[model samples]
Target: MISAKHKLLLGVAMASLLIACSPADTPAAGGRPAPAVKVSTLATEVVQKRVQALGTLLAQESIDISSNVTEKITALHFDDGDSVTKGQLLVTLQQDEEAAQLSSARADLAEQERELARLEGLLASQSAAQTEYDQRQTAKLRAQSKIAEIQALLAERTIRAPFSGVIGLRQLSPGALVSPGTSITTLDDLSVMRLDFQLPSLSIKAIAPGQRIVAHSDALNDDFDATISAVASRVNPIDRSITARALIKNPDQKLKPGMLMLVSITTSEYDAIMAPESALQSVQLQHYLWIMNADQKAERRQVELGIRKPGFVEIRSGVSVGEQLIYEGFASLQAGSTVAPQEG
Candidate 1:
């Protein structure tokens, strides 16, 4: 039913198809097989345990400077950021009127005292009535009282530093009217600093006065030491935490009041089995780790964890020392899969 030319063309086509489908006698491009991946193992070791917390830096002592008397400020001796000694004059009020009153009071007191002395001499000689002598003595007492009142008024006009500290910016200038209890400036002693932090009430048992703490601030390049100075007797009902304070020497005056700092206190110490944080694997709600068994196969183990430190995590249970824990290639691992552990 076929012609000779058609049969010949068909035979050539069939031969070409068979050659294309035939298996290769040699391997395909890139002749070498992929090399096996190597995973490193880690041996657990005992380490000292520690706890960490965050806290703040504060000035040990601070106060607001204010005028106690109502008057126009006549002079200011210190500017913002000036360091002053205790009892140094800070502000002087308009006291010319008070000074004149003091002078008048002194003169009146002198005259009254002379008159009282004459009356006493007369009373002793029986030349003056007792009632008249008593009246003169009362007048002298009133004059002395006036002198004392004027002295007190003069004292009120001067504002002096209560303690040695750095002064804040002045709120009032010379010739400004100031009233009683008007804040003129703020003074703070920065030679020493304080850190206030809150701790869980449960940790109060382990903390005490005089214990050392470490504090860090992003503003500062280095960490500083602080000592526990006080602890609250009662825990805050809302937060269930106890307030604590720490004192730190700030000789350089680097630490300031209300500075936010990270504080850490060691609450306790104990031995714990820990591993690199990278070695931990989480499966659902539980933590796990891949370990190489004696047969050189991957095994999954559940772990109970405790406190986590900088580079390591405390293993409360589920593993022990001398065990080979898989540190890498965790994604490629399956239970019972063979592994080639690389030695360090």
Candidate 2:
């Protein structure tokens, strides 16, 4: 409903306000007071070519504690997750029958021994026949053999640790009958950790025993150094990969068995042109960076990158050593724009 003259006045005021609020172009773009940027020269650094793989942490030695004989558990010597030493008794089965047999065998062997002694004296004095003494000797031997057999049975009934390690969950309680092949628990040597991983056959030539690898545990949020202990002799026919084993020291017992770790293995080493990571800019799939020329102007260059190192990145192409690079304050710059270079 307003008049056309009033509408023209309102439009003119709005235009004036918009112009005042707009940002002005940089003074440096106008050929004075160039923007200052931090700069450094490109340098070469020795870097290792790395291959990544997923590895599983294994115990140095692991085994399931199982029974070899059918017997009732009479004693439980260790609890779940208990640390045990080699030859330590872990379980005791009902051995009363074996014990009674052993005692009876000893008594028979003792009587046989006395009879043999008496017969030996009689044979020496020419009062008894040699055949009688010889038969007594055979009787003593039979009794000794019987005793040994009983002792062997007792030994089998007594379960002992095969190695020093931490025991897993207790599967059988006291009085539980366990037969042959019945699992009682698990034992794992955690003093050292064995990491197993596979790599493609193409990487076989560069790997060998004693080479170093790095394993990172996301659960622990730490990196562990390990040495390759073994490499497979042949490649897997199905996957065309070779398995490698590395040993990591776990004196603190922080690393556990079956942990999934990210592994990094070095294949080769080479020198690379390196630049600060801060200077690189990305546009879609292409990467770009700014460099300072001898004429004190910013020059944008497309660059190829490699793995990132601490505080820097490897440059694969589009850049060379001895060139000055502007790492910071290049956001306000254009190709051929004047810049005040400051050492970074």
Candidate 3:
């Protein structure tokens, strides 16, 4: 809508703005200042090759304590969660019937024994028949067998701990009728914890008893040191992994059974060149790093990486020790870009 002269003035103003914004048209008084960047020198160090796996903490020994016979509990020797020793009586059931039976059997056994003794004396004196003496002896043996069986039944009326452990909550109170195989309580030997984990079968060559492994538990807020106690004899068909178990001492009783643990196992060790993680750039699937060449220019190099730690990453190849790496200002760099080294 404007006149041709006005349009020509507008075009001139746009041309001036473009020239002011252009880097080429701006400064040539002393050439461009070098872009400064933080740098680090690659260094070689020994590092452990670790294999990570999830694991579980378990009691060294654990069992569910239950009575073998159904009977009314007459007495409870220990409270819930009591620490007990091996053979310590935990519960006693009503055993009046068993005791009566045992007493009767003992009396019968005594009578039979005396009768057999009399028959043997008579047989030695030729006063009793051989068949009769043999019969008496067999009668005594049967009576003895009856007494033995009754003794076993009476012993079952009292339940004792099979091993030293801490007992869990008691399910039955005094006077409660407990049936055979009913829930009673749990016992756990927690002085030492067992760590169970699975590892790939391909790493079987490196796994062995006595190998050191480290474990961490969130519940304890501490770390535990353990040693490999066992390794699976065969690989699992479904997962293609092998089960392993380690023994960790738990003197403070902080680690408990069924706790999930983060475990680290050392599979190998080697020396590798490491560089600051900040220096690395990921373009698509490849990792690239900028290195300062002798001419103070950035050279992008693709590298193979291994294990990564806090602020550093392993450089398996494509970079060597004594090389200067650009650790910062990576966004402003490219292949053959000029850079000024800044101390880090």
How are the candidates ranked when ordered by lDDT, highest leading?
2, 3, 1
Tens-digit per-residue lDDT, 1-344, candidate 1: 99999999999999998787655422322333222334444445455444456677767779888778779999999989999999999999999998999898889889888887898888889998998877877887888899899888877898888888899888989999999778889999899898888888888876789998788888886799888999988899998988888899999888788888887776666677777788889878899977777877788899998877798888787877677788767676668766666653
Residue-level error in angstroms, candidate 2, position 177: 1.1
Superposed Cα deviation of residue 126, candidate 3 (Å): 7.2
Best of the candidates, lDDT: 2
Per-model TM values vs. the true structure = 0.75, 0.83, 0.81
Choose the strongest candidate by TM-score: 2
Comparing 1 and 2 on lDDT, the stronger one: 2
Which residue pairs of candidate 3 clash? none
* lDDT (tens digit, per residue) of candidate 3 on 1-344: 99999999999999999887776653322256667888878788999988888999899999888889889999989888799999999888899987998888888888888888888888889998999878877887888888889888878988899999899998878899998889888999999999999989888887799998899887877778999999988899998999999999988788889999988888888999988787789988899988888888888999999999899899898988888888888777768777888887
Ranking by TM-score: 2, 3, 1
Better of 1 and 3 by TM-score: 3
The regions of model 1 sitting more than 4 angstroms off are: 1-57, 112-140, 292-300, 329-343
Shift of residue 172 alpha carbon in model 2, Å: 1.5
**Candidate 3 global lDDT:** 0.87
Clashes of each: 1, 0, 0
